[model samples]
Target: MTTTPRSPAYPSSPLPSASPPSPAPSSSALSSASPARWPLLDRIEGPADLRALPHHGLGQLAAEIRDFLVTKVCATGGHLGVNLGVVELTLALHRVFDSPRDVLLFDTGHQTYVHKLLTGRQTGFDRLRRAGGLSGYPARTESAHDWIESSHASTALSYADGLAKALGLRGETGRRVVAVIGDGALTGGLAWEGLNNLAASAHAGPVIIVLNDNGRSYAPTVGGLARHLDRLRGHGPDAGVADPAPTAGTLFEHLGLTYLGPVDGHDTRAVEAALRHARSLNGPVLVHCVTAKGKGYAPAEADEADRMHGIGILDPVTGRPPAAARGKESWTSVFAAEITALAARHPDLVAVTAAMLRPVGLHRLAEAFPGRVFDCGIAEQHALCSAAGLAMAGLHPVVCLYATFLNRAFDQLLMDVALHRLPVTLVLDRAGVTGPDGASHHGMWDTALLSAVPGIRLAAPRDPATLRELLREAVEYADGPTALRFPKATAGPGIRALGAMDGIDVLRRSPHRPLDVLLVSAGVMATPCLEAAAALERDGHGVTVVDPRWTHPVPDALPGLVARHRLAVTVEDALADGGIGSALRTACAERHITTPVRALGLPLTFITHGERPELLARAGLDAQGITRTVTQSLTPRSTP
Candidate 1:
């Protein structure tokens, strides 16, 4: 599918002034209105007020709410399309159920902006995804209304099951549990697993599964199930329920939940009526609500490319935002260019992604060589296994997945691919502190996970050039499994000539002072390390910063570098456990080099949502933190 070559919108633009509807809430009217007012939601302070108003006013309110969201998110920058699609549904949800009592959970959490707007967080929208601002995803820490802090897709059902089960266990049956899942999320195996478990439980609680069918994933959600949804939605309400065969039809029905939908999700009354009916019924019932991804927005409506899956800043009038000027190429863009370049040279070269194409920058490869780029739905396991099979068939399979999602195929990556010693290159995108999406999406665990696989060589490049070089080396090295990782953001000017043999390279040096500390940084986190080294140098301590292009197996010349310095520091964007930091410590221990080494990365805890720099700083992976750690280690300890 050839997408219109439109310039991509960037997130850097300042949001335009929120054109709130005329007549802000008056003091007397606000006091007279219901006390259960959603405080932060100035536009929609209370659903009680909405229910009290005439039906015609409800539609007007929905329009105002959409405009409000657009304005708020434009300033803050958030999941714009998802929130846009759910304005009416969100209205209906608020209208129908008494929330805080009725448990409403968002599937991928991107659609929660509307929910947030309704639940007294309208002002917080201005700080959306910012450093000290409100989070992009729902956080229990943010509000009591937010029950589950879900950012990852395909998890609402599981959360619903567990919550519902726990409610039953506690003998608390007063509340209604509603889970809003998306069509894209249905591709994940966990959704099905949750469905099966929910079905098997004898003592079931009040759980309503709302399937928000948008007919799109990161890419146009590919699979037989997606095709089935098309048929179901196309059949409309007139298509009465009847079993064609003896076996339970539909995946959800097969799992034993009462399947009821293909409803017009855009229509507020229809969705509310369907939801009201589902609420009346006991046990688990799947209510499939069919809605457009970028609903009510003209430009997004015209957009065929995966329903404009979250653009940068957008223009309110035209729905087209200012694009970021091209500077240094992003790691994703670099990877895509190199993959396309390599694919042209070797016919055997093939690329695969587990639902991600545009985000991973594989769109270029898909456009250049359409036949070779295989988007194996959202099934990461299938993608990895398929890559293994492709390798067995003499094709160089490059399985591209997000750092977090690649964890799903660990077994397949180990036994099927690595054990077979297949020529499979796993390209892990978003390999570090992923800025706004929160802990669930961070690619921090890939290096550690992939490192455990015997014979699997892991290459983490610091820049675009080394990324290209590593890809070439990975493609050429037909002996065993090779993995490459980069950050969620852009790659800086990477030093290619680490050494003559393309091994570890010392990026920066200090001429004035002695080499007191050796800072080893991997992947995109090297930038901060360099800055830290510079800071230490000014403080009268010389620091040698090195980028071990390939983090796994610890480079041969690294020992010599370590021996030269009195203090050593291993800095990476990954988690401290089993990551590059651990590897360096182990190397020092094994080599019998008693260099006082300090390991710095993400701590052994789940981090919350924030901007990239803020999250890094909190994790102690930022330049200031790195300098402090190095400086402390370099200082002599006094004993009285």
Candidate 2:
């Protein structure tokens, strides 16, 4: 199917009639084993092929694509529900606009699986999100059709605004710039900033903003904007009997952009018609497309939590993750239980999350203390600043977020919380080399970033026991801000400390030997450090392994301990520069200690997607790699 080339000038043409609808296959037929023959899907390899097909064949092809996604994505453990929901929407977008020439940008990009399928990358799903394979989000290296490689939300509109402005400057006004943003991404402050700017730019070419309102970001969306969208979609008390008119002075219209729809996103013809109407308009236009997250799959739609927004390897038929994947107690679960218990004891204690009540393990706190926990939407910056306000009111607020997401609120953490010396505890989950989600999702930058914040104390728990102990210590410390971070993996059995000294825990020691080497472990790195120390001891070298529970302040006893040992090495899963290792090296230098200090951690580069163990090993942060590094350091080189 080819697109009709439009004139360079803006046209005031009427909306064209939609094609006749085809008979949709039954749910049973669609869900039954992958079809031996996907006649329409197999024949189409690109957008041109998709546009060439008869309009009546689109429904059957969508069904075939869903079945293909279920079989492939389930086997590889990638995003399922979001991709399933956007099948028709993606089809409508591709059908209406020429992709490469007319830029199409996805907000979070996880919903682009259908776009990948339509753009001839269907076979890459077999290795989805694997190292050196197809990324879970859009990647520029993979296809020309994908404009931005985005996983973080609420930034697509800003990108669209910039691209539209650039195209207008180049006299390429005929090229369209479209941004599809949703999954509660509009709740972010950045989205509003982009919207405000886009509305202000009256003649910045044609920028079509597609609002895919699914009414959820992890759980149902929160706050006033969600309510406004709900009313616009005819689901709230403020909505009257009849649907609102396109130019009824709605929020988008007031913001200076033309408003259209509350269109049925599942209907291919309807969404296509709405998009066509949007393209015909001049300047920026907003098309509100209402869709259901996990629309077709019964299991995903029935999932009360997140609508299977993300999943591990799961049963294709039942839509259930494997028993083993669910049975393990993860770091998030441990924090959930401990935080809930802590909330019961402290009435003045409160919690906040950035539209991630369940994902960051604040659901339990929200359940136990109904009014105490706040879902601040996808606005991390707002969450941090608001937590500071809570602290000012003589209350301690614990803000829970994924370590990667905390990057968004650094200015707030530094200026509002640390500068004011407020009693706010930031609990960061997934604080290390997060696997499979790719570079953008890794939680590797928190330590380096947090180190620069004055008056802030950071803790890296070694195990479940330390996580529980440090959490209580952090909340009770009323002098300044504190943060506790842990990895995304399961919290294994507790590692008993051999002894304690000045807030540091000694995990292992060489028997009856001089202090030849000191291993300073940060949080979850204790296990591998202990293993590497054992290997050094077996080779007849004295080694000591210790976990500095609070890694940021550089325990008062650390410089002296480094002074006693012949060599000191710090191990962490965070970035090497400005991490615990760098801090310790500086501390020893200040105290006039002569011992050599070495730092071991992830390099300052975008590590690709892979399993946790595999990625760690590649970065030389695993047990074997650590042992090798230590041995190599001890080997003296001849005078050059």
Candidate 3:
């Protein structure tokens, strides 16, 4: 096929004006240089424009797109490495197949930056991740070409299978479904489950599974699947066990499907050829393309660790973020230091992370005790069940996971660990309302989920010192499952325990012994709770602020404390429904205490991506929001 250097998709859309470099104190590293214009990219308004380009000029077009990615992503931080890696592969697919009639889905949509550009959403890059900005992930509202609105890993094959089945039932043979899944996604059980169904004769015909293998997810994917992929590549550890010269038709074919490739993903023509060959087949086919993560950008290519999987603001030329650093350690870093110390004291202590070795702060712990740490890959359920087994086998296993991911392992947490009453500790990082990755990312479900599990205890650490202190307490409590959760932001000013009541930390006590409000703070909300309490006190209401460090058990002293105050208020960072506040109210009722208790937290809704502080304020979990709520609570109700 002949290709033109330009496409009519862009429709002469001029670039958005470049903003000045952010202040040293801001999160971005923009404005060191202005954005560049690409006559080639400007012409690319749709797939038709991309198809019109000469096959030889397609290479230059890929280069221009890659350059555009680095410039825009550096100016406004997003997934830089994955987008850089998928340029040629994306172009090849778009060039070979007609979208809309042919559905194209990205498994974990972080790599869809190039897709968005080619689909006429190029101008949305400027406001990426802001409230009204272009979403960091795909949205059904974005375009007709974007068929699915999911960012979860390893679920694409299942979606494709369902779509393929639907098309068969409706006799829509003209339409096709193409799923582009990362090799890193293979570790998840869903991928295998989908493959099992897709390989069957029932869902056969016109389903192309494009396995974009870069060999890492946050880090190198850790599982049997990676080894199988290595064998499929031929002449890599354990090659002779099956066939010395194995191809895609080897392992996947054994499952009753055709396999094609070991194709150079960077070669546009080669990828197009592979895709074309797979598209012609009457049954499901797997086209394996091996590419480098962070393919073009020098900084990303040189960085071996995660290939800059997700990034903050940075200089375009050197890829340097802001010179000023975060003032304090993030909750994950704090957990890392404590876990390292705990590992030193206890020989049986072990940690497990699901594919996120670095992001969850297990790298140092893994380095210190190589034998004790395990990376289960993007497989959360497996990690939890494995931790349960480790706990049963005379080991103290701590499952370090992101709060958003913990929801995925509810079954394992309930049946495997909680039912057995194992002494496992779950360290939850990025626990509440994480910024910028969008709705699917906010970790606001853990407290609610754990509340339902019998014998499970959850702790929300409010500050750096409490995280360290509480994590140690969680480790020592070996009778049942315990979780120590904290948000992604920097640890705030520490609030010390002035006194203890049934394992609760009394941070502040009103001089007027009889308090107007019993402020029960669950985890990271302690700082805001204290500020809100001060505001209440200045307004002539007696307030007592306490941090229920071990919040899950609903401290025995809490009901009695609640009875002392005229009213009780519980503040948390989790979802208000079934969260700490609701739990506290139920506990209060169970103890026959009738103090008017109010629950303050994020309302039941999908919190959009933005800075942590800004999102918190919007959710009414910040100091001012809390203070305003508390003040309104004190007002006398007018009879309507």
Best by lDDT: 2
Candidate 2, residues 295-335, lDDT tens digits: the string is 77778888989888998898777887888787888999999
Which lDDT tens digits does candidate 3 get at residues 151-185? 77888999999999999888888877899999898
In angstroms, the error of model 3 at 440 is 0.7
The TM-score-based order of candidates, best leading, equals 2, 3, 1
Name the top TM-score candidate.
2
Q: What TM-score would every model get versus the actual structure?
A: 0.87, 0.94, 0.92
Model 1 agreement with the true structure over 1-640: per-residue lDDT tens digits: 2111221111112222222222322234323425334332354655565556555555556665666655556555567777777777777787877777788899888888878777777667667776666888888888877888887777788888888888888888878888888888888888878876777777769788888888887667788778778767654342356547553266566666677666667666667767777787777778888877767655666778755566556655555665662365678889988999999998999999878888888899899889998988777888989999999999999989889988788999998999999999999888888877777788887877877999988888878888888899999989999999888675666554434434777778788678889998887767888888888888888888888888887888787788889988888888788887777778878889888778898887777667778888887888999988876767673579
Q: If both were scored by lDDT, which would come out higher, candidate 1 or candidate 2?
A: 2
**lDDT (Cα atoms) of all candidates against the true structure:** 0.76, 0.87, 0.82
Off by over 4 Å in 3: 1-36, 238-249, 635-640
Give, for candidate 2, the lowest lDDT window spanning 10 residues: 2-11
The worst-scoring run of ten residues by lDDT in candidate 1 lies at 3-12
For all candidates, the clash counts are 2, 2, 11
